[model samples]
Target chain A: MKLSIDRQIYSDACISKVVYWLSAQYAIERTLDGTIETLSISRNDGHPFDETELRSQCLRLLNDYKLRQTIDDETRDIRTILYAKAFADDENLTVE
Target chain B: MKYYLLPFKFTRIGDHEVFVNEVGDMLHAPIGTAEQIVNRTIEDPELYKSLVANFFISEIRIPALLDVYAERLAEKKRFLDDYTALHIFVLTLRCNQNCIYCQASSRDEHCAASSMSRENMRLAVQHMFKSRSQYLTMEFQGGEPSLEHDLFLYGIELAEEINQTEHRHLTYVLCTNSINLTDEVMATCKQYNVLISTSLDGPSWLHNQNRGKQDSYEKVVKGITKAREILGADRVSALMTASELSLNYPIEIVDEYHKLGFTSIFLRALNPYGKATDNADWEAYTNRFIEFYKQAFEHIIELNKQGHVMIEEYAAIILRKLLTPWCTGFVDLQSPAGIVNSVLIYNYDGYMYASDESRMLAEENDFTFQIGKLSESYENLVYSPKVKEWSKVWNNEAIAGCSDCALQAYCGADPVRNHSTQGDLYGFRPTSLFCKKNKAIIEYIISCVIDRYDELMPIFRNWIR
Candidate 1:
């Protein structure tokens, strides 16, 4: 339960995930304690994606890298596992 | 199928997820092990990812997530019940100068008869006031708004009269050359509380060359200084254009504004219409113009760093996109198109142009924006099938680059500009020089302000707010 990885790995994962949700133009700023303090982008262009899930996935991706460090896990396999179910349920949306 | 992962944190309570803002910031929430949710998600793999891809990026709008998701971006944008047009009333196309790249300049004096008559001007004003939108702006444009001082005065008084009599809320402005800012004109403007805009195409030589037959440089500097003296600094500002000769002296343009004490400069790209198309060849590759913009803007930002307090017009517009979640009310950036959304252009000849650019195109016999006429009822002009079709086409925000760009939400691409310049509602080459020029400015501002930025956040927020 005390699963962890180096701050460097976590940092890389965090960067990758933020870059995932945002282009290089955005990121989640962190406090000295390494806790996320803000989420921001580089431009005012409109965003239509879910901010909550985007953040959640970004964190999840970081944890996945951490999990790989602690367990006998495949990073590629975990990424696949995380995204596999996205297609079929992608359409279950409500229009305004 | 949910499997626990490590090292990541999520805003969660037990197993439930939390929403984030446009910037990824979340309100205070109890932290739960993202590991647990990942494990739980892993157990029922398809269910979790499906919900996610749907909620996060899919084209469909998921109902259960609607209120929550909409709230996340509500800070950046709002759901508007109605769209408005940006009315740019071209009071007179009879410009004093025969500049090579004057987009609205007359190709010949043939258009001298095209000045908006007093009757049409009154009708246009009446219709604009009677319109349903609470917010409005009436822009006086011309060979110089001051040149037609009486008609310009009549237009402003009419607008103010309607403002008090009909209880209409509107802002009055004029785009003019500094050459004609007589004391009488200034008094009329002050009485009306009008915002006046002018141009300074750089130092004397450059300014004189394009402005025609007169001492343009001295004229603009003096006029602007006088207008500022009388109108107060807040009401007067200027725009710059980069023509062929201008490409060689971009910094001089910036310097000219600084010497005159302007805090903002609009480095407007030339719209290739009207007199400009004939002179487009006067400038070389647009890439050169990009170099001009890039250098001028980057230097201006450096000046801002040194506390000179200058802004590149294009950059400020782009910075608003990079820094906020909403669109600046710039007419050029509107979708459903700002063309007919807020303002309709009534040409001097009594025809309605969808946008000012459309009027320029009219020089080539193209009348895409001639939606109606002052001779006709204004109500019928706005609600007509032509207006609807144009608005519909304008509103269908579906350019590939725009839809996919990270900054799409921050921008309102001007289809009218694109339609006039590139001849398409959605230009496939948005990544081309024109688009890159816009994008680079955003890139530069973001590069400059970001978290290392402490002072500009207020202005940045104001831009989008």
Candidate 2:
């Protein structure tokens, strides 16, 4: 199956995340054409999957990865702080 | 109404979105429920109440129970609270059988130099007592630990002598191929009340084929029976590793165990180590193992329905996380990755490794997980700079892909696996076979609970009990 995803909407990193999970099921090859990212997917052994369901699942996973990316982006500083508070020594330091 | 969202993730299981919170509290809400919660537009009063009760959403701007939630999360990770409770002493690399997928890379029985010396065994026993853990499990492993009957006996005797005054609760386990389990080994096991943990691949032909011996299955079965006769049926147990050929015979494997009168089966996957790395394709094997696990689990459930008490241990471990607040002592599924925290390996070379897999890696000439030397103090071994490094990426919550996973609460972090397979301590999740296998199995287990709750719950409860 060949599908072109809007690179503006889904970053290469996000697309890679989705592809990583699907790599076990599908042999995925990615290429960049200007602003459009093309994904060529084929089953490792069996016949090709249904294009509609495959695309839908891919987009769903892409959305999830993007959401997680957003969460990770937003919470990066807080997570560092939390870890520092939980594990690192900070007895002499004051929280501003 | 204003609301607060706790740390959680959701995935579409069947038609509904199942949400899981940080502490493993879960709720199956309808599609678009996540968006509604995000937008603060969940209008259904009952759904809202369920969300709040299940720790998905809190109505208070700043929840008063945040401290309590932190405490509960700490409780869920209580395995980290205990010191290394399981100390494995790999007595030797000498064995009788040449199993095809032998992870230990065992040498022949005549190779006396491959076995642990009495001095190392004594030092290892003293090291075992150094841990402040009230409960300690001293497990014996080997090429075949039973081959070095003298070392095994001496190790146990030293531990028993120390426990006379130190008096920490002690449990002894012998992990053997059972082929070398002679009358002497059985008598020693009976004396110390040592539990015999043997490997049984499947029925006769499959078992023998995997072990590279025609009568290996017979020897193992005979060993199991003999051990049970002396140690009591409940004390002796067996575990199976799904080799490439074993994948094609899940039901047969379950039947073999049932025929042997064993109540539980741990359908463990093959690690990519030692001679077992001969497995051609792990991705294909993992998928097949998932199917094999589901089929065998269903068969076990059917047997339970027929009034036979049987359990699939992997399911039981995941189910404990899903159905109860208590955590399992299983090392593989732990966040700190069960290395050093829950289990440590004292190899014949006098080096203490993080886990059994660590020692196996050492056999392949990789010492990535050798934490310390047995000659060192337990304090230095447990609190080494290397162990401090492992603590960094050992939590799933702290990992990149695993952090956002809905099953993170049920799953764990394995730095050793990641380091071995992916060439790093922090694993790449998207390409992780560990993540793929655990996710598929855990999701399948939850699907069973969700799709066939009434029919399976009684059986699941029976197994856990």
Candidate 3:
């Protein structure tokens, strides 16, 4: 199955994360065009796979990873402070 | 209204969005509710109140209970406070039965060379006492531990003798095939109050097929019954590994346990180690096992409804993580990759290994996880440079793929597994079998709780207890 995903719509990192997951079942190849990225996927061992199902899974995973990226972007600083507070032993430490 | 978004992630589960926070607090809300939280457009006052109350969203710069939350998080990870509590002693690699999926590579029963020496056993027990843990579990494992009667007895007797003066709470467990539960073994168990952990795959035919012995099931059942009679039924427990053949008979397997009057079953998966590495396709096997587990778990729930006290132990472990503020003592599901943290292995070869699987990898001549020799001092063994290297990738919150996962709170890190399976200490979660199996099961459990909320709560409550 070949998918031409819009680069603007989904970040490359998000697509890569999804492809990494599906790589166990599918041999995925990615190529970038000017504004579009194409993913060429085939069964890993020449076994049977449902093309429609794979497409749905890839799209769903892409959306999920995008959400994760957003969360990572939004909470980066606060998460660091939380960890520092949880593990740091210095009583004089301050997070500003 | 201004809202401060606490760290959380949401996934669609059967028409509902399940939100899980950093501390594993979960709430299932209607679809698009996740969007509402991100967009700050939550219209329902009660839903917004729940989000704030559960640490999903905060109204202030930090929640008023930030210190309390931090304390609770530290308490959940209390396993790291103790040096090590579970000490496994691999008595020998000699065995009587050739199991189809034996993770421990076993030699023939008469292979005296594979057995742990008396000197090694004494040194290993002495080394176990060096840990400052108030409680200790000295677990005896083997190709068939019962075959090495003298070594098992020696190890236990040494621990018991030490505990007399040391006064640490000590418990002994014998992991055996149960085929060789002779009277001598039973007598020792009775004397020491040793708990018997045995293996029973399924019905007679299935068990025999897996064991490669026609009379294997009969011997095991007879041995289990005898041990139960001697040590009391509560002291004997059985765990089953779901092989390819066993996948086809999930109901029969649970029914078999019920017939044997066992109250709980641990549905374990096959690890890629020793003889079990011959498994051709793990992706297909993983999918099959997930299906098998769901079916078997439902059957267990049905059994509970039918007035039987049946529990699925794996689900119980997950429930403890999901429904309670406490963390489970199950090493496999721990953050820091449980190896050398919660449990350590004193191998038959006079070496201290990171985990049970660490020694199995050694049987194949791979020594990535060998901590040190048994003769080494406790300080040198634990604080060695090799262990220092492992510490970097052992925490799930610090690892790739896992760090971003919403189920991160419920899942754990497995550096040994990553080193063995993926050839890296830091695993890639997208292609990780450990991640796949856990996420599927945990998500399915959450979905079940949402889909059958009122009907299944009582059943789930019973299982977790």
Candidate 4:
């Protein structure tokens, strides 16, 4: 099965996470050309494949991870400050 | 209006999107609520305030109460400050009953060679005091700890003698099968105020079948009765391990515990260790155990509704994580993983292991988890090179699949279980039965809270209380 994901809509990190999860049951190969990333997936045990289900799962995971990426990007600094304030002895963190 | 996003993770449960923060506070919103929150389009006044109040968002760039948020986050991980409180002493590997699935790899009662030597016992006691924890729990386990009565008694006496100068609040627990809870054992327990934690699988036929002994149930029941009479009912508690056969009888198992007058039941599943490693299909068993847990939990809820108070201990631990700001002492459900952070095992083989399951792995000649021998320094044993390797995979916040998981705060990391089941310390979460079982059950509990909040919250509140 070949999945062509638009890079503008989904990210490499998001698509990579989906592939990592499916790596247990499937052998997935990825290649990027221009803005489109193609995922070539095959079953690990040579069993029958569910193309529609697999595609839908990839899309859903991609959406979820993209949202997670947004959250991480927004909160990374604050999270660092939270941990420093919580554990660091010097408590040198300051938020503007 | 406009608000800045705080750190939170979300997953779909039932028809609602459940959002959990770093401190494990859960907020159930509509399906598109997360996208709305991220896009800064939340219009519901109540939902917006809830998101702000619950630490999911901030109206300002930095909330005024960030210190409070930091404190709550620290409080959830306060178990790290306590060091290793629960120290397990594997007194002997000799057991009376022949269990079909013995996780401890217990030998027959006649196997005195498997017992801990007196020199090792004294050294283990000395090592226990080396921990700086103000509170220490000295738990004795064995094929049957009562088989080594003299060693058990000596361990407690030595702890008490040292505690006079050490000034630590000490608790002693005896993990036994209760078949051989003799008068002498009861006297020793009474003298030391030691708590009895015994096993009762279920009813007679089921318990006897799982135990591989015909009269096992009767003897255990009689032992429980005697222990309660001599050592107060509150001091005697029981735990039930869900065997392959026991999974078919969840309601029967819960009812049996209630019938035996137990206030709480820890419906634990079989780990991949010792004789239990013989299980043919762990993935199927994990799925079945999740179903069994739900069935038994529903039955427990029904019992509580009938004005009978019964607590499912596993749910209570998860509930404490979700509902309270403080962390639980449960070793299996912690971030740094429980092995050495919360527990340590002084095995009968004169070597220190990371956890009880670590010692069980040692019985199978897999000493990947062995810390060091009893003769070594406490620092050397705890901070060994093997422990350093384990520490790499111990934190769930850093693991691959678990790092981004919405349920990471409610779940834990187990490098030992991963190594045992998957042949590596850094386990693949997609195929991990431990991961599957915990996620399914934690999601089921959250679904219950969403679907039947009013009906189950009071009962859950009482259980956590």
- lDDT: which candidate is best? 4
**Candidate 2 positional error at A92, Å:** 16
For residues B1-465, write the lDDT of model 1, one tens digit per residue: 422221112233223343222322222122332343444433444544543443322222223444454443433333232245345667676666677667775533344675778998888888776666677778877655566778888887887777786775677787887777899999988888889888878888888887664677787778888898999998998998777778888778898888888888888777676666765442254667768877887677667667677866666666655544555567665444567665677677777777777777777787766777677876788789877765545542355444324334434656666666667755544333445555555444544554335766655544444
Q: For residues B344-373, what per-residue lDDT tens digits would candidate 2 score against the true structure?
A: 889999899998889999988899999877
lDDT per residue as tens, model 4, B1-465: 678889999999889999999899999988988889999898788998899999999988888999999989989999998999999999999999899889999998997599999999999999999988899999999989998899999999999999999999999999999988988899999999999999999999999999999999999999999999999999999998899999999999999999999999999999988889899999889999999999999999999999998999999999999998889999998999999889999988899999999999989999999999999999999988889889999999999999999999999999999999999999999999999999999999999888998999999999998
Give candidate 2's fnat, 2 decimals.
0.11
Q: Tell me the DockQ of each model, to 2 decimals.
A: 0.03, 0.21, 0.42, 0.84
Q: Estimate the lDDT of model 1.
A: 0.60
How does candidate 4 fare on TM-score?
0.98
TM-score of B-chain for each predicted structure, in order: 0.79, 0.97, 0.98, 0.99
Which segments of candidate 1 are over 4 A away from where they belong? A1-96, B1-85, B107-112, B279-284, B430-434, B447-465
Using DockQ as the measure, which candidate wins? 4
> Least lDDT summed over 10 consecutive residues: which range in candidate 1 chain B?
B21-30
Q: List, residue by residue over B1-465, the lDDT tens digit for candidate 3.
A: 797887887778789888888778899889878777777889999999999898888898777777666666766777877768999999999999988888899888988789888988998899889988888999999888999998899888888888889999899999998989999999999999999999999999999999888899999999999999999999999999988899999999999999999999999999999988999998889999999999999999899899999989988888888898887888999997788888989999999999999999999999999999988888899889999999999998888677767777788999988988899998878788888999999999888888888988898888776
lDDT at B116, model 3: 86
Score candidate 2 by DockQ: 0.21
TM-score, chain B, model 4, is: 0.99
Fnat scores for every prediction: 0.00, 0.11, 0.37, 0.78
| 10 residues in a row with least lDDT, candidate 2 chain B | B61-70
